[model samples]
Target: MVWKDETKEIYTEEPKEENIFKKEYGNTDDEFTYIEKTKGRDGEVKETVKVSIGKVSRYLLTKFNFKTIFGSKTDKIYFYESGMYIPKGKTKIKTEVEYLLDNKCTTHIVNEIIEKIKRKTEIDEDLFETFSENNLDLIPLKNGVYSIKEEKLLDHSEENLFTFQIPINYNPKSKCELFEKFLDEVLYPEEIEVMKEWFGFHLYRRYFIKKGIILLGEKDTGKTTLLDILIGFIGEKNKTGMALQTIAGGSDFTKLSLKDKHANIHDDLSSKDLSDGGGFKIATGGGHISAEVKFGDYVQFVPFAKQSHATNKIPPNKDVDDMAYYSRWMPFQLDNVILKPNPYLKDEIISKELSGVLNMALEKLKYLLKKNKFSYIKTDEEVKVIMERSGNPLIAFVSDVLEESENGIITKEEMYQVYSEWAKNTENLRLSKEQLGRNLEKNCKFIIAKKGTQKQGRYWNNVNLKGNYSTFLTSKKVIYLQSKDDVSLLQYNKNKSVESDVKEPEETKEEEEKIEQVKIK
Candidate 1:
């Protein structure tokens, strides 16, 4: 076809078919190229274009910077943008490719380019985990990114595919008086310090200090507000809102929700007992998590989020005496209640004082980095109180029923019998006798030793029931045991030795034998 440039006062001819295809799309000579169309999709004359396979692949692979992660049942592609890489759905990418080609390429053609780009840009899945924790990719803020080792901002690079970002720009001198008032009114001085340090820990890639936080308080208390501040401080996109029950439930689907989240928030947490704490321990204890995407590949990554929970009632724990389990929790109970709550006050603080809060958290993080550990130390009494409030049945049982004395002694059988009865009467969950023995030794500091030659059993020394089980069994009369055959009640003589009664009737003897051989059902 011949075309004339009337405005230029010259006559020119359109390039031949083979010549046009040979011409590069831009000044650079690249494998991928594009060409203009003389007719529109409706067969009308118009200015439109269609892209080649190489052209579309190059555009997507360069413009969006898509990285393909393989080595799983299914291939996955993540596009880098906004200081992070986001998982892009295949269906969406196909649509985008079709648009660039003016819907000229078949589904097969589009798929071919997509797969070509992915294979050419394929990266080992392990690189995601390694690069995420690299010092240079530690913290990606809205204005700039930071390294965990320094406060200076590093130059932005596409190689750093950070998935999490602090929404606000870093302003070391930012201040908000309203946020200060809210914190002072809600948390004690020590609690505020702990809160700041905990928040600071969320901005990093690796968890140097692994501990979950729980805020205990009643309704209208500032517990939720305090945690909500953390949610705003780290932006909603960086947080995963899931309950402790779900996180510790051992469901891979639930576990997948924690990947790359800055915080796992459980606001208004339910009062469910934590039946399994293994998942919770791994989440806050810096162990790698293997979570599978539903109908997709399994992703293994170390969790970077800090868990924070706000609850009206502390949840019960199955592993209450497991020090390894309980040690991961840091509790702060909110005592102040905002009787007249301003609903918009939280929003106001986030909008005005969020940057200041970030700065405060940064200072706390710096302090922790200098010390190489968390500095907020809880008093012994505070620790005890927190343990007790966490629905620890042993603590309550020990306080209300047991006593410690230098000369006190009780057999394991007798102690278990008393504990079982006490648990039944108090409607508490009864632990196994063997577990009770371990708890006694670990918590009460009581010595466990084999009984004397008289019987084959073990006895707990220096710990006994405050009230004798004899009275607990019955209020009828004093009963004494002599030579393993004794009535239900127990009695000790002046020398604390067993002795028989003066008269031994046949029926009384039979009753004593039955009591001695009685079985617990």
Candidate 2:
């Protein structure tokens, strides 16, 4: 009934929800839901509950000094692009705010979100850090089912399909069968263990293992197959498809591309590919390499993703002579190949077998984390091949010609002759007198020009197992060639041509042509 004195026009308007905030803030009872957990010492347990004041997101935003204006008309959160609060209305708001958040979309909201993110972060912060860190490479947890972005890996944790696509039916047995089958064909039986050790290295990368891998193989040697499985497990976006040279000789754009990669492969390279200058010294964290955004401040981070190079021909031995750099390079030889390319092999492994292999790798990662130190099992065959192809004939020559001098001393002249002969015989580049002197001094603390008490132009003194260039290779100070058989290190080097053993070291187009002609003849 309408009152005659009062003009009652039918009026409908939006309901006022101001009291919703008052209930959570001003009211105490019947507001908060209390959840409790017990914490005690000495076999005792206690329980406690907290009555929180407001919505977690809003409370956190204010707590972190991130003041966002609630858009009345749009029903969205708005924060200035400059990470500030003006407390002004939406109409005629200054240009400081990049734009208003649209309820229609979460896209292009990164700037607003970034304004809200506090410098101090906890577990969830790490999850959000994928954008800022540019470090998206996923590491497997001890539980065999956790992402590296997670700060905590609980015992009750389970594998996540979205993170690195670790499969549902991961069979370790099947993985072993596939890996064994693959490696058995590509490498010697003894060296398979080394290959296994290196394969598992990618999983426990948070340990900051600086080691990279060199996979040397002919076509169809299962190297690409292994990489295919890796790419399947790790989504393409989380890796670099760019060439190694692009990464090595970096620009602002190239540095940006280095982000988010797990295994950055420099596929199918030859010695000439890295001939002008090389990347290992910087890419392996040998030096502090700086990267930056275009027209932005420069920043540097230790790269976690391993830099792998897959090639048919081996890199020059001398180029890899620095033990500090070379020691981190794990080289595997895959000489044998499938004569007929079975395109389905990749499908079988990635679709059917890879998940199992991933689980197997996770198991190894668990063990590695528990061990806490690198106890990589070194295979004799792997060691032999790694040294021979390392581009420095000195290591091979030492293994062949040099004996453990009783006095632990040797003349520079004596050593030079050994290297010279090895160079001529192996058809490798020879170090000049100055370069040789520098290398001896840099690696072994042996000064070539400095003379000893005896009649000598240069002397290597204080030579011991622990204080030499090849000391890190094996436990023994004596070279393996000390044995009576005295087999040449050439047997370990696969790609070396016996007939054209005296080829020149210059990595020019003309030089490559000359070598090809010799091989043809």
Clashes of each: 0, 6
* Cα RMSDs, all models: 15.8, 17.4
Stretches of model 2 off by over 4 angstroms after superposition: 1-127, 130-176, 205-207, 242-244, 273-282, 286-289, 294-298, 317-320, 371-521
If scored against the real structure, what TM-score would every candidate get? 0.65, 0.47
When summed lDDT is taken over every stretch of 10 residues in candidate 2, the lowest stretch is 475-484
Model 1: lDDT of residue 54 = 71
lDDT of 1 by residue, 1-521 (tens): 54432123333566444433221233223234444434322234333334467767777766677778875577878877677677774665787776665546677877888788888888878676677765533677877776656766666578777655788777777886777667655665567677778888887656677688888766666787777888889889988988888878857877888888888998888777877888888888788898988667777878877889888667877765577766677787665444456677788889888889877877788887787666557853555557564466676566655677778777788777767765654456899998997786655545454565556467777765664332323211122122122321111141222223333436544533333332221
Q: How well is each residue in 1-521 modelled by candidate 2, as lDDT tens digits?
A: 21111123332442233311111113323223244443222223333434332333243444433323222232222232222222232221222222322231242333333434322222231232243234333443323334444633323222121233222343445554655565555564456665555555565433255566677665666678767666665545556655555655557556655543455766776554343234555555534446774555454544545566787655554444345545666676664444444567667666676656666666555555556534545543555446454544555544433444345655666556545544654455789876776765554323233576665556665442222332222211022122212222112342343223333334434433443343232
Span of 10 residues, lowest total lDDT, candidate 1:
475-484
- What C-alpha lDDT, on a 0 to 100 scale, does residue 166 get in candidate 1? 84
